[model samples]
Target: MKKILVLGAGYVAQPLVNYLLKNTQFELVVADVHLEQAERVSGNRARTQAVSLDIRENEKLEQLIEQTDLAISLLPYTLHLQIAKACIKFRTPLITASYVTPEIRKLDTEAKEAGIVILKEMGLDPGIDHMSAMQVIDKIKADGGKISSFKSYCGGLAAPEANTNPWRYKFSWSPKGVLLAAQNGAKFFDKNQIVDVENDRMWEQTWPLQVDKFNLEAYPNRDSLPYISRYKLEGIETLVRCTLRFPGWVKTMAALREIGFFDSESQKSAEKLSRDKLLRQLLHIPNGTGLRQIFKERAGQFWTEEIEERFDWLGLFENTPENRHNENTSAIDFLVSLMIEKMSFAKNERDMVVLHHDFIYEKAGIRHNWLSSLIEYGRPDGTSAMARTVAYPAAIAARFILEGTINLSGVQIPVLPQIYNPVLQELTNQGIHFSDINKKI
Candidate 1:
């Protein structure tokens, strides 16, 4: 049997691991920094092995890549470049859920020459989002229609039944990733013009979105201008990709940003400060200041009852001894740590993944609108929706590569019909189908 080496057994790795073991004949080797975590995922399966791997050890990492027919990296995006180099050196196919950076893109010629595929962005937003959109876009083109506008939104959130928290969200994946994304400036196409939102104003600029009676908010995700060419939507007048969240999320995040909670700069004086002291310094309040007074002074008119309640629930204003701030923590890290403690999914709670795409096309002088939406929920205390939706596509792509269905050799994404169609069909068979609605406008 062919062998697949999975790097970094993280929160989202288990579903991919289980899918390969149950559905394929490939031998699976899961490697991570923590042996127990890797072993937990492996479960002593007949064709599976777990090993401790510190990716920094180049010799060991390269050796593992050399031994496997394919390498699937579940590591952080920053580490994917090194793994991609190893995969090239070993002449092994590679797949990852992370975005392809410029550095990784530079390896396309090398990977093409080696006749090995290095597929990137094979997970949730970049994965299903790209595949599902392309499926529609291609059909529209084939039907002699031209897409006039396209907008898409995706989110990982608490299921309706598990929506007890004020935030209406829980960490199904990395809390740090969610926090880091909040600080990104966004650019999207609207009315034949490029609209850019600065990082500080991202949260303040949101659109109200309604999905099947569930009211939510949408804010622009990362740069969407590049996708005009990436998806070949040259004549499209409007193109936007956004992230969905509950109604109050944007306001809460805006308040947090106003208070410098998302700042990444290091503060030397905060090294030995207590939680309360750190809060005082960060907010520019005196040490003896009351929490309410400090909030009033610092936030001015930006603070609302919802924001105040969220901060109070997170114990950000409390002098509790257990909330001891980390000595070396950056502002963003400190906020992420607090979010991890306050916003984690409970044992009995379920998470949800929502992906919705809107396509407006014109055919024979008539305008038509097509909407496709996917809503998947997780089993309580089992595989999360975020994990399943993110990992399953990668696993499906891996199987396809092994079966010689995907024979392309280069650094690529799932925008082509050959790549997206089969994966979308398989996703439907695996109970991750999107509901489509068509109408004339």
Candidate 2:
């Protein structure tokens, strides 16, 4: 059996751990800073250990890589370089959820030389969204049509009923990372002309979107135009990449931005606090067992008084003299955290992964429109939508790699037809399929 090692244990990590343990033929080993979390998720079915990945020690990393056939990093995007180096050193295949940063892209040449595979963007957006959208884009192109533009969007959200907080969000995953990402407001892109939305300008933009049965809102999360070359779209003129959000979320986010939630111009105060105190101040949100009791007159269950109180005591949301009214994390981070709590899948209520794709193409001198999307709501705690959506693609990709169905190596992605078509086809066979809707020109 193939030996697989997974790093980091978070909302995304749990699903990956559970899936590998129960389904695949691989012997799983999970390493986290927190040993209890690793054990809690893996039980005795898989190997669970505790290790600090904070400071990179090349030899130790190589040993782990030497031990496992594959290493799936559920860690931060920033940690990719170290992980990538370790993978290359041990000639082990690798995968991660981070966007392929330029530094990472540079490793492509080295990874290829090493004859090892490194797969990035294997999570939800970069994971399922990329492959799913490409599948449709390629299919439409083959039908003999001139593509006008492409806009793709995806979001991890909480169930509707659970959205009852001031921010309508929660901390399903890493709150600090979420807090840090918002400062990446603008990017340089080559869509038509040079496009730039820097600093606070990022919060100023909003786009409207609709995919079959759902109404949605979106905002550009990162660079979009570069994908034209990556996706091999030669003549595509207009394209935009966006992040999805519930209604009214944008305005509230904008207000938070206007108030300095997006500001990372200063962090001296934050640097002065002890780690525990700093985290406490940063996560000090008001929370309670009973929204009616703790919040009583506060907001909703999205974050009851007890929850806020914990956050306050813990230093997440509430304002306190101890907090010192300083910005410990980014507003977008806080917002994403807030959304996680609000949107997380529950024991009974199901969680869904929705990927909406809209394509416009011209054929026979006629312009036409086609809107396609895939909606996969997860089973529950035992089998979540997040897990299924995330795990399916990786599991499918791994099988293809192991079975020799997919043969190219190097720093790779899900842009190829062989990878997506069969993989998506398999997902469809398992009740994960995208729908196509066509309208007159």
Candidate 3:
């Protein structure tokens, strides 16, 4: 039997691990720094083993890769290159849900030369989003049509029934990732012109988006220009990929940033500081100034009752003992900590995943619009929608690679039809499908 090594057993790893184990006869090894977490995911399956592994320990990581026919990395994106290098050394196929960075792309020729495939961006947004969009774009092209505009948006959120928090959001993944994304600038094409949004102005660029019954907000996500080329949309008038959130999210995040919550430069010198003191320092409030007053003075017209209530709910004004410790944490870290404590999903609470894509194209001398959307919810007290959507595509891709259905070698993504068609079909079979609404304009 073939062997597969899965690195990093995080929240999203469970679905991928279970899917492979149930569907394939391969011997699977799940590795993590916390061996218990891996073991828990393994579930004492016959062909599965869980081991303690610090990916930073190069020898141990390489040894595991050498023994496996394929390696799936669920580790942080920063460590993917190291894992890729090891996979190359061992001539093992590699799969990851992370985006392909420049460094990772540089390995393409080498990976192809080694007769091994390095597939990246096989998760939710980059994974299903790409596959779903390409399926339509290619069909449009095949029908003698030209895409004029393409816009896509996605989000992980609290299901409507579970929306009990002020933020209308919950952490289905890393809290730090959510905070860090707010600090990212974005670039995309609009009417064939390049539009760049600076980090500070990212929130300001959002507009209301109506996805079915939900009134959400959309903000550009990272650089979308590269995707124009990636999607082969050479003369498109507009191309943008955006993140979706509740209506008030942009304004709240903007206020948080203005208050210096996203600042990573400031460090805590003291061993401990009360929440009020921490807030005062971060917001630059005077010794005698109250957080409420200072917030109004700095935020001016931007301050709202909703925003103040969010802060209050987070206990930013309270001297809670839990918020007293200073592990030399930065402003971002502190904010992330508060969010993790407040916004985490509770047992039996369901999370939702929303993916919507709009394709504007001209066919047979008539303009047409195609809107494709996928909305999935988690099973209460069971597998999360975020985990399933993110992990399922990668798991399906891994199965294809192992079964010789996907025979391409080199660094790649699930863009081409051969890669996307079967994957999309299988995803549909597994209850992860997109619905398309087309209209002539």
Clashes of 1: 0
**Leading candidate by TM-score:** 3
Segments of candidate 1 deviating more than 4 angstroms: 265-275, 282-284, 322-326
Error of 3 at 429 (Å): 1.0
For all candidates in order, the CA lDDT equals: 0.88, 0.65, 0.88
- Residues 32-55 of candidate 2 have per-residue lDDT tens digits of 677676666566664444454442
lDDT for model 3, on a 0 to 1 scale?
A: 0.88
Superposition TM-score, candidate 3 onto the true structure: 0.97
lDDT of 1 at 231: 97
lDDT of 3 by residue, 100-170 (tens): 99999999999999999999999998899999999999999999999999999999989998898777788
- TM-score per prediction, in order, is 0.96, 0.78, 0.97
RMSD of each: 1.9, 7.3, 1.5
Instruction: Name the top lDDT candidate.
Output: 3
Q: Considering only N, C-alpha and C atoms within 3 Å, which residue pairs clash in candidate 3?
A: none
